[model samples]
Target: MMMNKEQEKLPLPLLFRQEANESLLAFCRESARDLPWRRSVTPYRVWISEIMLQQTRAEVVRRYYDRFLAELPTPRALAEASDDRLAKLWEGLGYYRRASLMKRAACVIVEKHGGELPRDYASLRALPGFGDYTAAAVASFAYGLRAAAVDGNLLRVLARLFRVEENVLSSKTAKTLREIAYRMLPDAKDGTSGGERYLYDGYAAAEWNQAMMELGAQICLPNTQPKCEKCPLSAYCIACAEGCAERLPIRESTLKRKEEARTVLRVTDGERYLLHRRAEKGLLAGLFEFPNKEGTLSEDEAKKAVEEMGFSVKSLRALAPARHVFTHLTWHLSGYEVTVPPIDRAALPEDFFAPTKEELYRDYSIPGAFGAYKP
Candidate 1:
């Protein structure tokens, strides 16, 4: 097909218009990782995997994905899942709000969508926690729709390929990059006229999107270490041609992570440990945590704090200090192991309770941030 002068002048790169897409698809066919999420290929599975992959490494997500699916296999199951069960399944993954939002979305799916993920882009996007990227991913990878699932990997790949010098983190830059990705779709040349037809041979929309993501993840790596020699798109990559692939995708964000000091109390009565349920809102919301206070407290202060909770502290020993980094905050933690005499359950604080070791490990969902202090 011949392009008009106006179309020719568009920012859509020749790489996306010609052989680069084919090269990327072929590379993925030969070299894509045998990820577990790639096996089932259901809307529910795809939705879960994409949500889990957010702000998490694929390797780490693998450990939880299968187990989570085994327990809550469908939208109805997820919507009906108990808070304890949900928290336990999602423990250590961080970003607890994702799990909560997923549950809310599952309820909506069960009630409104007939216990299935919606098949269209706009409907999927309307679901709770379903951002444009996630909605696009489910629409394309699961439903085989012509939606562009442009994530960080694709953003990096496109930025380097087009040698974009603007701050890639900005919304304008990301939107532009996403538009370019949409144009690279197989039937995008004909706009909406082709419907679900694939213009490219032996390549589905799912494969194309996954291939682009895989190339970025495996070859066009972030920082200063992109493996240009192994990149299938290297021949057409403007950044590679200019010897500036490493610096092409600029990110000039000004946000800084706030630091916080915390003192964690691992108060135990020999066999049972004290756990507190966080409030139903805010960070780590509705998850279990060790009784902790703001600011690093000395051993004496920790003992006093525990006693103030109406527990008679029998013995106190200092535990090693630990730190946990969240997306926007860093927790510098000091801890104490306080041994207390067994007390009546009624005497415990409203949101505090002591559970046996087995119960704590099996029933409670302790955040990883309290790992160093958990009994």
Candidate 2:
């Protein structure tokens, strides 16, 4: 591959690269946490864990991972799971679309791949919700393939190590960083001599990838808060020597979150509460939620809103205000509890249902965004 002037200046010295690799691997061997996914490494387990880890904290994914696996242990099982059951299993995860796409991919796997995750990166990338990073992760971690899983963590680590000044989020910088990661793999060619140069291979490749990620997550952190003193790669990090590790990996664009107001209603008839299923597309799709509308409503307006849905309001009381933030949206919520007489089930909207308190908690997948308002 041809190198631009910037790329030419980015390559580390060969001896330093070798020492850095050994230091990183040793650090991982000694200090790596016993994460569940690392314990029992399977293609299916890796796939599930990677998906759950996206835009979610590893600590948070821990709560859902084991439960999700216990219920749907195999691709075939996940392929056959009902929508409601799947949604319930993924209730607190927030991104419902990932669950939906996983089901679609599972169905394809069961039909086309004999109920096993495909071992090749290309085939895995073709599956729903699988991207370059995910495909590479599964290939390297699960199948011992020589693929580099270049996630944000790895990107930051690389940028700091080489003192890259470009925006790490750009495609060009990402591609260059990925190439550097690939070259650092065990038994990878150094791109110079004709002779085959072998450093390490097989499971060692997986260990190297995980070690890089662990370093970034725990020591070489982002947001001007890197713990360079504890980082294994600090000795060789160009950014560390320059006293700018925190500012090395620049991001060009910062997304502005759109704010919105919502009025949530906890309409109940002493025993059962009203729930509505969101449309099958868009944000929070297909999940059960407390009946809510787009904007804060006055107490009288809240009562009128309930009546418009064909309900008789016996009493109305305001509940505490709540807020939930998504990736690019913020919901400022106001809530109300409305007591009503028992209504005719047959007259309710097809998309609406009234479930007893016990049933609501046990069966429905009410998102945590409305947790503050749930009775």
Candidate 3:
């Protein structure tokens, strides 16, 4: 790959100024996907969609966006929703914390912002789950403000466009890219109408920001080699010119995920499975799960463990083992089917509730980590 010493030292924004902006917006106007969130533009819609899009892809988010809005149409609805309903709607999205935070943020908006999202960046950032990327997204896309929202996609595009050698995952590198995005915004801001609908003339700040993100998602993909020949900004892309577009956005090596062995207890009578509501603070908070204990156990050990929990185990059979991966950890799960006498709700531990198969299907919300063992 060829190297340009001077280009490596130049700021990303200055390297691809107006020429890159026009190419990106023009490409987007012709090639942007017809996403659900883009069709109905609103501060609330953008807020929910952006939060959902974090660490998740657009295609996956498509399945949930409209349904979530259909159920919780307003901030008040979301704030007042039952935990089961919210979790059920957001089931399979993988990150339960995002759903939890969205509920909290809705309450804040209802109580403090008068049931509407604040139009300013500072106020939006103050809301739960609205980080720099999400806040700037709401400000620029929903409000037509000249704010730059730099996300992973946009970061890759900028990093490759200017051949940045800095680690893109670092906070300092993120701030630098955000500055570049701010500089790349369209020169004029038309401002929002302070309502739920918006229409841009293809060169507005919102369009520009979306265009950059779209280009990154469609052309400058992260996992594979970028389609530079089809990219509108290829002419000005330093990485393309240097034949190293695939290697520009450098990231520090990630730590290995810690492995855990777990034995999932599926204690059942004829009516319902023994379930418990997790603590309201840590991982999988407020979600339902079958009774489980750490470490894989033998059939005799499993029966003994359940008896220790104050239940008489009748029979035990080992089921298949499954694995679930989180961002920092992986759970190697061994499941067991244990038969027991009918549970007495009064005798069960606090916060433990057994739901019948029908009720579990229709009402409860279990985390994806327990999917393999879920009946």
Candidate 4:
């Protein structure tokens, strides 16, 4: 009874999504804690969190989420925030361009929507930094419209269930998953509305989205290590039924990781840590860090770059090699803790100045990538 990969991806019973409810309900009823944004599910909180979660882990998002919510609790506050300050707030979250695009959208809301968040799809999609997925998320969660939202996690979960070997990121797979999700959305009449719709908008937008996402994030995983026995959808999963739980999501071979070398300067005199604010553009923009030159370089090249930046390179002390893997490339960092003898104040730009260790700790936001090289 050999089955090809595509053959293994046959359609399941209509109850596939319905059967997932046990896990979803378990997560919602037993495990789901009240996240800060969960308390209100306003357009503002929904929009911000959805945007923040892009390519960023949820645990990390929790930390930034609260601070960002506090700083900009309402669309008015977000609209009022300066691009420079907003970018700074989003410093370590990476994908800096999203922050800029978000600001542009906020401006639109303030000017055109009167600081009120839009409820429909088209208007929301038109906003900068928001695409189809984000627009659907906001429309459903923020406004309770039953638009299906798809992301990597969703595609992974769906592909495995259907035993789909198609490119998970392909436009076709994405469209299929979105259609399936929308089709399987709990009816409004199932809960308590007495034939009127049972699954409320809240359930569709907030609960369903969270449940599917949490399942993907927590159980139905990417690696060949998913705990099928523990997965709520195990009973209905095509992979599980066929005793091939780990192999259903047929994805193509991964592209090679692009490697880049960065030379980090942990510039410090005896007392102060020399740090620089990256330009309000490019990578690491709006974050504070020791100066670095992109691409792997020899000690001589690093020194030349540092000297060219007007900082005297006194001594280069080696540190443990630290590697950071970004989305498309891996950064192999060879850090040398350099100490520059105090330079004349006149040698630097008026905006750049020396900050002590205390000041750097108190004020500067250094990315974790270069932290090991910190002076």
Where does candidate 3 stray beyond 4 Å?
1-17, 189-199, 253-256, 344-347
Number of the top-ranking candidate, with TM-score as the measure: 1
The superposed Cα distance between candidate 3 and the true structure at residue 243, in angstroms, equals: 1.5
What are the per-residue Cα lDDT tens digits for candidate 4 across 244-335? 75765666646778888877766677777666777777766666677777876677877777778777788876667789876577888876
Residue pairs with colliding backbones in model 1 are none
**Tens-digit lDDT track of model 3 for 1-375:** 011364346454554446666667668778888899988888889889998899889999999999999999898999999988999999888798898899999999999999999988889889998888888888888887767788888989989887899998888887777776766665653221122222454326787778888888889988567999999988888899999888778988567889999999998986888888888887788788888889989888899889998889888888899999887889999999898999887778888887888988788887889988888
Off by over 4 Å in 2: 1-17, 188-201
Q: How many clashing pairs in candidate 3? A: 0
- For model 4, the local distance difference test gives 0.71
User: How large is the C-alpha RMSD of every model relative to the true structure?
Assistant: 4.2, 4.3, 5.4, 5.6
User: Which pairs, if any, clash in model 4?
Assistant: 188-197, 188-198, 188-199, 189-197, 189-198, 191-198
TM-scores of the candidates in the order shown: 0.92, 0.90, 0.90, 0.83
Give the Å shift of residue 323 in candidate 3: 2.0
